[model samples]
Target: MAESATALAIMGMALVTYLTRVGGLFLAGRLPTGRRWRAALTAMPGVILVSLVAPLVLGAGVAEAMGAMVVLALARRVALPVVVVAGIVVVAVGRAWLTG
Candidate 1:
């Protein structure tokens, strides 16, 4: 009985969390976040991209990550696809070199 009760409690908490995340999708259309919020939302992608990539470049503290960043910087003046390929190549080489 105690085990079942604990399981039920955990299940309930998981359900609540799932609902909260999904609920936002439904409720978002109704919310009037206004012009400022809309403008901020437009900028969110770049913000999120930086948020994700910045940590990888700075916090990863690995040779591959540093090499990738350098390649990425060079690619900026050249082309985006070039930068992406450079990153992949750098990572693959670094991993193989470091591991083997």
Candidate 2:
């Protein structure tokens, strides 16, 4: 059935994603190819995060993009919970203001 196929596809995608992240960790831990290789591995997580988020942020309107900027600015200085709250507040207020 279509529903069963969709579920299988979702599971396949999830399995592949999990394997890729785990494979990166395994390689990073098990291999010492060189400094450049290690550095690339070290940057993998950030690169993955940006890849996942950039599309959503770029496709969204000003409010969402501004919220993402606020998140980035606050992410380093503040705690995760605080940053999340700030982003939510900014996006909500921005949307309201823009819509008015």
Candidate 3:
């Protein structure tokens, strides 16, 4: 019964996520295409990314800080996937070494 309840919760969350993304696409299609609007939309992803990462870098342990630096240094030189994997590795190693 607990497992079934957990599965239902997961499915409900998945549906909400999918609907939110699709709703954004529909809304975006109707949104203004003016110069400023376009620029703001273009910059939104980076803004969201920085908002998410800033808290971790500011408040988290050394491992997260090191991971953020690794992400920054490799951001321009490597593919995004590689940079993400590298950051994960650095954080994992940093935590194990620093905490253990």
RMSD of each: 4.8, 3.8, 3.5
Model 1: CA > 4 A from native: 1-13, 70-89, 92-100
Cα distance off (Å), candidate 3, residue 42: 2.0
Candidate number that wins on TM-score, 1 or 3: 3
Candidate order, lDDT descending:
3, 2, 1
Which digits, one per residue and each the tens of the lDDT, describe model 2 over residues 15-91? 99999979966765677679998788779889999899998787888999999999999999989999999999999
Model 1, 19-60: lDDT tens digits are 998997898678778999898878988999999877777777
Q: Candidate 3 — what's its lDDT?
A: 0.94
Order of models, best TM-score first: 3, 2, 1
lDDT of 2 at 37: 85
- Which prediction has the highest lDDT against the true structure? 3
Query: Lowest-lDDT window of 10 residues in candidate 1?
Result: 61-70
Residue 30 miss distance in model 3 (angstroms): 1.1
Q: Residue 39 deviation, candidate 3, in Å?
A: 2.7
TM-scores of all candidate predictions against the true structure: 0.52, 0.57, 0.62
Model 3 CA lDDT for position 26: 84
10 residues in a row with least lDDT, candidate 2: 24-33
Worst 10 residues of 3 by lDDT: 50-59
TM-score of 3: 0.62
